[model samples]
Target: MTDVVATTPGLFPLPDWAKEDLSDLKGHQKGDLVSGGEGGEIARAYDRVRNEVVDDQTDAGLDRFVEGQARWDDMLAHPLTVHENVETGGIVRYYDNNNFYRDPRVTGELTFSGDVAAELEAASGLLGSDADDRLQAVLPGPYTLADLASDEYYGDEAEFLAAVSEFLAGEVEAFPAHATLFLLEPSFVTNAPDDDLDERASEAIDAVAGATDADVVVHTYWEAFAEKPYAHLMDADVDALGFDFVAADREANLECINEYGTKGDVALGLVDGQNTLVEEPGTIAERVNWVREQVPGQEFDTTYVSYNTEPFYLPTSKHVEKLSAIAEAARLAATEGVEA
Candidate 1:
């Protein structure tokens, strides 16, 4: 029985230990935030926030732990955008949410400076033996990052996408082979139709995901599977495919899964990540069971029962409750599956 792992997207509500200055820091862009230096007050606050969320997720029995990414004020565009030659541009909407990311203009060659892995290394070090194989790190997928950025140096879109993939692969190569990495690919589902775009995107995604020696889970959220170019996701080489059922039509998502079939594991975003309506574990378990009913006789190697999107939209208390409920639902599902 695969355990329902409590994993979330990078962005999350700062814990109580984080102060108002940190809250103010949230409104600033990545370039502006980085000007304060890595040893300043905001960095310390982010450290506190990371510790709190890590402790919270671990205490709640979450199977995988993220660094909480409290420092990612620019959302997924950050850390990468702040590198050597990339210039930060105007604020733009990040998916179907109020959140935004500074448009990154690739003025020069993009290179991974090993910062992404280093960001998680501290948090990973804090994890005991229990979380050795369970500590997860997050990276914006190549296609999504390319979609979010402007190619100033590499004018050719194809070459730019390949560059982004190689840049991301550098980070993937740096991560410990035992760690799990989540590649967020919201652009895959929301972008307009392009015949070659889907295939190129899938190839770039597969290349970046394949760079890592450990398990990689590619997640697409904020849209239905049928409405998007995600049908090609089956061809993307990754260990798991995660769908946001709360944002998509649940029936449509299941149909897509049944039609194409998963190449590896399945991650069901069964719990709501955009609201304050605290759902219970029993309720989530019932939803999991209902999803299972939709896809019969298919053994999902590792079903990740987690949030449908970023949980930062929910209130602090509600987010905590939602995290616990997700793990409980996974536990209940595993027990029931075993009994059956």
Candidate 2:
């Protein structure tokens, strides 16, 4: 029997209390807070928010918990934009969404300074002994980072990609042993690279995955990959590849799985993260069974039922409801068996 786990791909809508705390701290610049000029109040606020996020996930009965990247103001560009070597440029629209992130302009060599690892350590501290069994670390994949960045130093696309990959690998190496590592690579579907560059991209992903013992999942959202890109993605040495079942091309995504078959475990983005409508447990379970039936003879060791992407688009209350729904749906799917 396949085990269905309830989890998310990271980033959550900030709670109201957290928003208030952060708003008050906004008067003081982040640099001053980071440099300990403001008594580290900003850090303390983030810590409290992370703790609340963990508690909420635990109460919802999720099998895994993310650090709830509450401090990431710019989503995918946070790590690079904060680095001294990279300059923050004009705001660019994030994918096709209304959200915008300041473009990271690479002015010097990309280097890892434990940006994400520090967040992971703080999150692990919250879970205590159970952290090793439950904590999941989330970060932007090298390809997405490189794609979003404006390279002024490397001058070459492949070199820039390699450097970014190496930088991320360093962060992964520094991470404490955890349950999962979610590499969010939305660009793979929204703006996929040329076929000739597919091998290099997969190699970049493999390099990051090889650095950690955690179960590595390359998650893509916004849309599903076409046949060739999906095939190239399967070539990567990751434990699982996540697909957006809520996207318009979901049927094509299922077809890709049927055609190529998965290498190991599979993460089904059954919950629509962008929408506020809560799906019933029975509906979600039926979708899980549908996926299983669509791809016969292909056995998945574990099926992770999660949001198609982060639910940062929703309000905190709705986000909480969605989290509960995910856990309940996973339970129903496992209890009823795939045939049901």
Candidate 3:
């Protein structure tokens, strides 16, 4: 029997209180009225939000917990934009969504100085004894980061991708032993690179996966990858590959799995992250079983019932409801003997 668990593919929205605190701090900064003690106010506000998110996830009985990525101003590009060598450029729409993120322009050699690792460390402190077993570290995959960035220094795309892979490996190396590492790669489905570079992309993903002891999952959302691209993605030596059954072309993705098969573990995105409607737990469990039935003989050791993408697009109240539904669905799936 497979072990089914509840988890989220990271980024969560800030709470109303946090928003108010941050607004006040921003006002003070613009007026030059910020005091020395207030320099750490933003960090404090983030900590408060992180604590609340962790508490909510715990209460909902989610098997895996994330830092919630509340500190990220620009979801995928935050780590790169914060680096000294990179400059923030004009806003670009985030993958056909209403959300926008400033482009990270790479002007110099890329380097990692514990950007996301710091956030993971802070989140780890909240879990106490369960930290090693439940805490999940989320980061942008090399291919996604490279694709999103504006490369001025490394004129070549291949070279830029390699540098990003190496830089992200450093961040992974800095993390303490944890349960899972979700390397979000929406670009794989939204804006796939050339077919010739597929092998290079897999190699880059493997390089980062090899850096840590945790189980690495390359999670893609928004849509399903085309056949050739999906085949290339399977070449990576990561533990599991996540698929968005909600927003993706379900029949196409299921066909890919039936033909190509999958690895030992898989993540099923059953909950609608962006929508306000909450799904019934039994219905979600049925979908999980339905997917298992579609791909005959493809067994897995673990199955994650998660949101198709981050729930940042939803209101906090609805997001909490979805979390409870995910946990309940996982429990139901496990009880009903749904094979992974």
lDDT of 3 by residue, 1-340 (tens): 8889899999998888877888887433311212356656766677789899999999999999999988677788877888879988999988887898889999998887686787788889999987999999899899999988999999998999999999999989999768999999899888876777787888899899989888888888988877787788788889898899999999988888888887789999899988999999888999999899888879879998899988888889989988999999999999845444
The best candidate in terms of TM-score: 2
Give the worst 10-residue stretch by lDDT in candidate 3: 26-35
Model 2: worst 10 consecutive residues (lDDT sum): 30-39
Q: What lDDT does each candidate get?
A: 0.76, 0.86, 0.86
Cα error, residue 37 of model 2, in Å, equals 4.1
Each prediction's number of clashing residue pairs: 0, 0, 0
Model 3 stretches astray by more than 4 angstroms: 27-36, 337-340
lDDT of 1 at 226: 52
| Candidate 1 minimal-lDDT segment of 10 residues | 26-35
Per-model TM-score on C-alpha atoms: 0.91, 0.96, 0.95
List, residue by residue over 86-112, the lDDT tens digit for candidate 2: 988998998888898889899998877
RMSD of 1: 2.8
